[model samples]
Target chain A: MLEIKGLKAKVEGKEILHGIDLAVPAGEVHAIMGPNGSGKSTLGYVLAGREGYEVTDGQALFKGRDILALEPEERAAAGLFLAFQYPVELPGVTNATFLKSALNAVRKARGEGELDAMQFLKRVRGIMKSLGMAEDMLKRGVNVGFSGGEKKRNEILQMAVLEPRLAVLDETDSGLDIDAMRIVADGVNALRGPGRAMLVITHYQRLLDYIVPDRVHVLMGGRIVRSGGPELARELEQKGYGSLPAAA
Target chain B: MARTAQTSRVTAPAPALAAQLARYAGLKDRLAGAGLPWLRDLREAAAQALAANGLPTPRTEAWRFTNLRPLHDLSFAEPVALVGSEAERAALALLPALGRWRAVLVDGRFRADLSELDGLPEGLAVQPLASALHAGAAGLDGLLGTLARPDQEPMAALNTALMEDGVIVRVAPGVKVAERLEVVSIASAPAERAIAFHPRLLVTLGADASLILVDTALGAGAAAYLNNPVAEVDLAPGASLDHVRVQDEGPAALHLATVYARVAERARYESFTLSLGARLARNEVHVTLAGADGDCSVHGAYLAHGQRHIDNTSIIRHAAPACRSRQVYKGVLKDQSHGVFQGKIEVDQIAQKTDGYQMNQAILLSPEAEVNSKPQLEIYADDVKCSHGATVGELDEAQLFYLRSRGVPAEEARAILVQAFFGDALEQVPDEGLREALSALIAGWWEREGGAG
Candidate 1:
């Protein structure tokens, strides 16, 4: 479960998310559709506890706890995952090692025994196969020379492995081809369960066709202007957000 | 001389002062009586220049970065004569078995009993400089005196004035020695804390002949000993040679060496220097590509910690047309230790098509640790590619956070990055065993300095 009440966030001294309220219970996929300059990415980053995002007002609660005070790593350990719109390239560090370390860190923080290297490799290799990622990607430096689509796909692979309680995919399908988009959506859908929630943030409705969100919200100027059922996504896909009625 | 007078009433050149003056005085009279007239004049000039310049002071330009106050602390006179033991002889036997033609300098004296010459090829001769000096090889005096300026550097001058016995390897025209020439320089006990060694080597490879020179220096005990060494290498037209120098003296020892080399037309020379020793150690190497199509590659690595001061300075000159030179030096300084790398690549006007690159990088784990790196390039040629880069900094915080975020402890992450930092330096080492040994030594130094992974 996730909740945001009166969330007013400013980046670089300019307010972006102004007075927003939202809630998502378990076992549901919520799509946040917004036009350019709509603060959708800002919301995702703020939820992940990125630095320099001044939370001037409001509190974000994840799993009934204030998530605003946690560091980025602490938030990750607390079962909150943010698939970045663009992943940072880390040279000289293999993806397999990076993922295993992340997994063990979270496990250790949660009072679980650390997985051995063999155990980690077996499990992560299986996840990679299911996500349609090549085994070679595990050996190279993390996203050093990855294609745009490969980077997005790598993000999805991380989401599946981490298996956080709330997974927020920020524009994961933007630079991806149809096949990559489908693979990414399938990877996200594989984690759908009764105890987990998903927030699919996107600019276009094409990705939603495969992931199939249960609820849709139109975010404008850092606030959710409209909320409706799944048909709202299809409605906006056809008629576009320009013809939508003004918020009351 | 300075330390003895300052600490105690006893002056320097105490126990051996009379013998010291007697040894050089006798040698000077003998050279004056016999040998080439020109070489006799050169030796006298070198001695006179040394008496004037004296031991290097911190004020000297070449010794600016390195302070010799510790060296001046103890007065050094001629060491009492020391003989080799059976254990020392046996230990000298297992020396990597470099070549059929081998030369041994024990306590600065040439030891024929510990040398091997069964597999030596013809047209190549490995003999003692003492014999070569008496023979018609006065050309060595010319090469040594001209290649390195002794008056300019006191240590080099000291080595020249107090010169002892070492090997002189000469490869004749079109003669390629299939085996390597191993020169093991050992310092004995009586020479322990009191003596200074000036072990000199001269290696000349004739046209089209190839040779390999392996030099290793070993010291005894915790006493203060100084090994001031100088080597001159000459490569003729179309000749090739590989030189590997390893200095691993004892803890309280002071090792200093300078190598001057010349590569002729279409000749190639590759040299590497690895230093892991002494309280204060400095190795200087200057090389020149003297003719067309000459190529030179020089590399060095020094790992020091725990108050050790190591300086490696190299100058590679491209003096001929169509010559190329490459220099790569890397170091790791931990604790309160200091490491210095001052490398220069000079290209003259005739040296067109010259390509030179030099890079020096260091990882400072502690704020107290220091690394002074100056990579300089002086070019007078119009058509050339020359670039120099020097970087001195700590590890990247972002990479560190990324590693720690992955569940690797902070210590383990730092070790991994440090290993990668010195990876290129070790990779350049040609010998696997030596490379592994150096890597292990570096790792041990890191851990000893409280770097736990």
Candidate 2:
């Protein structure tokens, strides 16, 4: 469902992602385990088509179409979602209102009927309840005062509502407690199905225990150094990424 | 010969304008015979002071931020007759009705027929100024110029000199009015040329009494009308008030307003001003905490689109010990619009434990948009907590990207962010319906403004 060829990205005239090539097929979960400053968030931002991240030289194809030229909203409408590592606080716009407007925007792009207030409320409340968020949070401003764990959970709730074709979770397990990690992993696990793909980026292997990935790739120095199965994650947890052989 | 004509034009004095000033000078003696003897001396002094200083020039420090080049050539006649037909009155009546007590001022004249004040509780007197003058009340003149300063703004002084009838509401001691007092001032030219009108209002709440005042202004046509309004509020010991001033004048109107308020011991004063109109408008609000343990909240929102210019200058003085004050003003300027906010908090040496916070934020929508913000704090007390912050910037690119990445359109995203920027000021409004309507009006203006460069 997603393909990348020598993805070289630069921010502020300095190259960050140098010659990164990766691919993920449908119905498969891939975990990109990397150290800090290994261009983990940069890959997620590049895939989500965020502004200011100049594509120096690369080709990113989603559903067999070049997506580097698309705007962020256009990429979102074409079924690409990026669960941010840190959610932005919008102090006046409510969570429910923001979600509904977003959903309607995507629906309109798909030529679908818009949801009214009641319908939208019902939809968001259901997802929010499953995510263990209070009903009052929907009325308050979006992530204005939410804690670190709650922010991540809110991102997951958005992912559930958007139901995009390709989901990229950037360090989603950074600030979660054990229980929240399990719940977030379960939410991602529930969305697993045919013709859908997910790319989970994390520094720890603990999240893989809940939503086991079909493949684990060791990333260091801006490139995937090694690719292996689920056992590779357990080995890394026992030892560390330092014990792995360096890629030539 | 051309040089001679040019010299004549430069040396020629505007005798007609001078005659207008002379006519204004003679009104004091006429007012002395009209009763209100205490007001006559102040009126005469104000007239004399204005004649000496003339009108304010752009070079003046107080008027430095606002240029009156457009109003320099404006030729205004004396107040015209109120010109709203039966249909016009009916059309205007359908607009938003303020709280319970409604006082209507049409074309600078007080309309008692359109107002309803049937059962004001005992000791609460809501009457016209002319009536108050006729009643020989000894307290009328003592409190008249106590709040509104004359020499501060030329327009304010002019309004004081040529003022007609206005509303007077006084709450008895220990009595609180359950409903808000709504003062609606509507301006209609009906005539071909432009004119000027001044409305003066005085509200006094006795010890332990409280009330809310909402001032709204509206006008029509491209008439060069000037709305120079002054509202004076007196809060006795332990009195509280929630005042909201909404100014939505016409595009061609020039509005200058002043709100002067004094808080007694343990009194609480909360004020919010919304300036959303006029080609050029300046609102000056002065609040003083005279007694101990007083609290004040001053909030404002100025939404100026097109070529409109809106300026708000506020001063909150903490004179007594152990008083608190807060001020927040936000502006959204689009097109070639301009906005200015100048706020200052002064704490005396004896005013210990004074807590004051002032913040001003402006969002410029276009490259041509401009905002000038100055938040000043003059504190002389050692045991005081005072801070002021000012920020001028475009919308957050990261926040915009986050919203758009969720499928929200670019326009809707910008509108939401702008509304959020204004949400703090809107939240201070006591009326929900008016708040929502103002939000809708902001959205409508954004839509009509198209894309912001």
Candidate 3:
């Protein structure tokens, strides 16, 4: 379960998220829909504990614990994951090496035994096969020359491998084609269970069609002005975000 | 007293140059092949040049970023013959044994007892430089001191003036050396005194011959010493040579090395220097593509920490048409260490259609760590394709955050990124085993200097 009470944040001198309150309970998925520059991505980043985004006020609670004061790694160790909109390219680090280091670090922090090379390889290969990724992708540098679709797929693969309790999907479908969106959706759908939760951030209603969020919230003017069930996405798609309530 | 002082000041070179002159003056009688007229003349000329130029000061154009004042102040004694001990042999065992053909040089003198030269294929000759000189080897007529000129390199000039012993390797025309050749140079100076030795290596690969050379220089114990080595390589038409040099001297050691190479038509030459030791070290390489279609690549990686100063300077000349050259140098500095990379590529008028590329990158892990990178390109041919770039920066914060977000600790994340930064340059090594050995060496260095910093 995740809770954000009056999540007000700012980048530089400008305020982005202005006192927004939202919550997604266990075993459910939520979608935050907004127009451009509506601070949808800011919510995802602020929850992931990224630096430079000053949380002017409010606290983010995951599993009844405040994560705002933890470092990014500590938050990650506490079962939080952020699928970046744009994955950074690591020039000389192979994807396999990066994943192994990350998995082991998280496992160690959680007081669990680390996987050996063979065990790790077997598990990774299985997940990669299910995701329809070629084995060579693991051998290449991390996202150095990956295509848009491949990057999204790689991010999904990482999410599946890490298995965080609360996953934040930040515009995962922005640059993807329809087929890529379907594949990413299928990957996310495969990971859905009673013990996990997801917050999907998107600018359009097309992604909601694949993931089918349990609830939809319309974020406008740095606040969530509307909240409804799945039917709200269809209504917004038909009428557009221009019909949202004015800011307080 | 004033008249005497004036006379001495007028006659004497600068203090540093005077010290070097005095050292070389005392070393003249002990130099190898002193009876040989040509060798004597070479030493005399070099001594005069060294006295004229003195050691390169901070004001010198080539050494502006590197100060030799520390090297100038030390008084280096002539290297004495080292009697191999159990400790020395034990120390040598720590080096990576990657090659089959191995030669060991203790204190710059070839150690036949420690060498393994049997089973060499026909048309291949490997022997000590002193033996080759004394025996009047047939190829010695015009090979020694040909590529490295004293006027161009003063430290090389100093090396020439006091040269002692080294190795001579020759591969006949059309002969392919199947096994890699290993040359291990170990310096074990006395604890109280600083010793200096010049080791010269001449490698001549005949037409159509192929060879791989791995040269490792290390010091034993905690003694202070100077290991000055000059390696000259001549690759004939259609020949190829892969050279890997690792300098892992002692903490109190000073290492100055120069490599001169002449690549012939359709020949290929590749070299990589891994610098990880010495209080102060400079590895200079000069390569010339003498014939058309020649290809040459020079790459290096340097790690400096704890007041260490490491410099990698290279000059590549494209003298023939349709030649290609590449240079990539990377460095990581920490804890008040300094790293310098100066690479110059020259394309002559006759070398039309020449393609040249050079890149230098550095990562400073500490606030006091410094790096100076200079890349120069001189093209007389208008049609040549040449590009050069240099970058100095701290570790990428975004990359660090990404790695850390994955649960990697701050120190582990930094070590991984630093290794990756050097991976681009290390991949240039042609041999996989040697490359892996060097990579492991870099990892060990990171564990010591990179993790905490």
Candidate 4:
């Protein structure tokens, strides 16, 4: 469902991702594990078409289309989702308003009818119930005063609501506790199906324990030096990334 | 040319002022209260002051951020009354009726036919200024120029000299009017002629009286006109006045309003202004808390785009002990539009234990969009607590991207974020209908204003 060929990228004139090749076939979940400053987050940002993440020399094709030419919103409308490391705080916009606008925009772009308030509230309430989120968050400003766990849960709620074909989770587990991780994992794991693809970027192996990936790739020195299955994460955890291949 | 020493402080006088004064030199004789001795004296004194002081210039400290060259560049004539014409009907049709007790002023002249004043309570009096002055409303002479004087402000002086017709609202003591009152001021000058009108809005609330007045102003003409209104409010002891002003002028007009409000012992005066229109506009409000335990709140939000300039200048005085005041002003500027907010809070030495707070914030949607905010606090009381702050910025980049990342278009995301900036300011309005009206104006500004070019 997603393919990156020589995915070289840079930020602020400093190259972060250099000559990387990765592929995630339809219906499979892939995990990109890396240590600090390993360009794991860079890959996610570049794929999502975020501004300032310069794609100097490479092509990232999602569902047979090179998305580098599309704007961030266009990429999103085309079923590309990036769960940000830090969700932004929108002071005046209610969570329900933000989520509704987003879902309707995506749906309308796909030639589907928009959901009315009643239909939206029903679906959102059901999802929030399963995610163990309070209903009052809907009336408050989007992420304005939310705790870390609530913000992440909101991201997951957005992912579940959008139901994108490909999802790029960037450091989604950074600030989450073990219990919160389990709930988020359950939500993400529930989204795993035959038509969906995910790229879980992480620095630790704890998150993978809940939502096991079909494939694991160790990204080091801006390059994916090793590729293996679920066992690779355990091996890397046992022997830290310092013991891996240093050749870029 | 008779220029005051104070007038010399105003840089080079604009030729438009000279031309305008020459054109209106004979207006005093044709004004509403022409034959009355006291009223005639008031107009004559104001006319002299208007000629001597002219208008404020950029050199003036209070007018530093806003240049009146645009106002001084164009000469304006008194608007021809369209009281009973098809044009008046069309203009009246455009005004949104907010409440049952409503008054419509078309080109500064009140239309009794269009107004609903049949069943007003005995103590509540709402009538046209022309009629009130003709019938000699009790104590009208003493209250007209008490708070706003001619030599003190040239704009108010001009208004006083050329003042034709407005509304007079007075509530008797111990009367609590539950229904809301509305005043809709519409400017409908001909497409070819530039018109100017000064309407005096005098409001008085007797002791223990309460009233809510919604004042809305707008313009509907292809040509530029000036709508200069001077409002004087007097609140008696234990009385309350919740005032809301919506300054939604047209693109081809100038709106300059001056409001002087005084609150007495244990009285409360709260006002909210939502300004969204006009090529150039300034709504200056001066509020004085005259007695102990008086509460005052002056909050507003302004949205400007294109080459428009909108300014909100205010001064709040705590004259008595234990009084409290709050001021919150927010503005959003796009394109090359300019916004200015100058707020001052003064606490007198006798006003011990006074509490005052003021905050002004602006969001510039365009790189070329500009904002000038000056929040001042002058406290002479040793036991008073007062604070003021100002901030200017663009919309948060991270916030914008986050909204867009969620599939909301860049423009829609921006509207959402900018509307958020006005949330708390809108919440300051207690009336739901008024708040909703203000919200619609805010949303309309975003919907139609072409992105900063």
Candidate 2's C-alpha runs over 4 A off are A218-228, A231-248, B1-23, B26-37, B85-94, B116-123, B130-139, B189-191, B430-453
lDDT for each residue of candidate 3 in B386-417, tens digit (9 for 90 to 100): 99999999999889888877778888899899
lDDT of candidate model 2 versus the reference: 0.82
The full ranking of all candidates by lDDT, starting with the best, is 3, 4, 2, 1
Could you give candidate 3's per-residue lDDT for residues A1-248 as a string of tens digits? 99999989999979999998999999999999999899998888788777788899998899999899998889889999999888988999999999999999999999999999998999899889888899999999999999999999999999998999999998999899999899999999999999999999988899999999999999998999999999999999999988877676
Q: After superposition, how far is residue B117 of candidate 1 from its true place, in Å?
A: 6.8
TM-score per prediction, in order, is 0.71, 0.90, 0.95, 0.96
Per-candidate DockQ values are: 0.19, 0.73, 0.74, 0.79
Model 4, B73: alpha-carbon shift in Å? 2.1
Better of 1 and 4 by lDDT: 4
The CAPRI classification for model 3 reads as: medium
Give the candidate number with the greatest TM-score: 4
Each prediction's interface RMSD?
A: 3.7, 0.8, 0.9, 0.9
In model 2, the clashing pairs are none
Best candidate according to DockQ: 4
State the lDDT of candidate 1 residue by residue for A103-176, as single tens digits. 88788878889899889888888889988889999998788899998898888877777778999889888989
Candidate 3 wrongly placed segments (more than 4 Å): A246-248, B1-11, B136-138
Which tens-of-lDDT digit does each residue in B125-170 have in candidate 2? 8877756666675577677777777766666677677776778878
lDDT of model 3, residue B223: 76
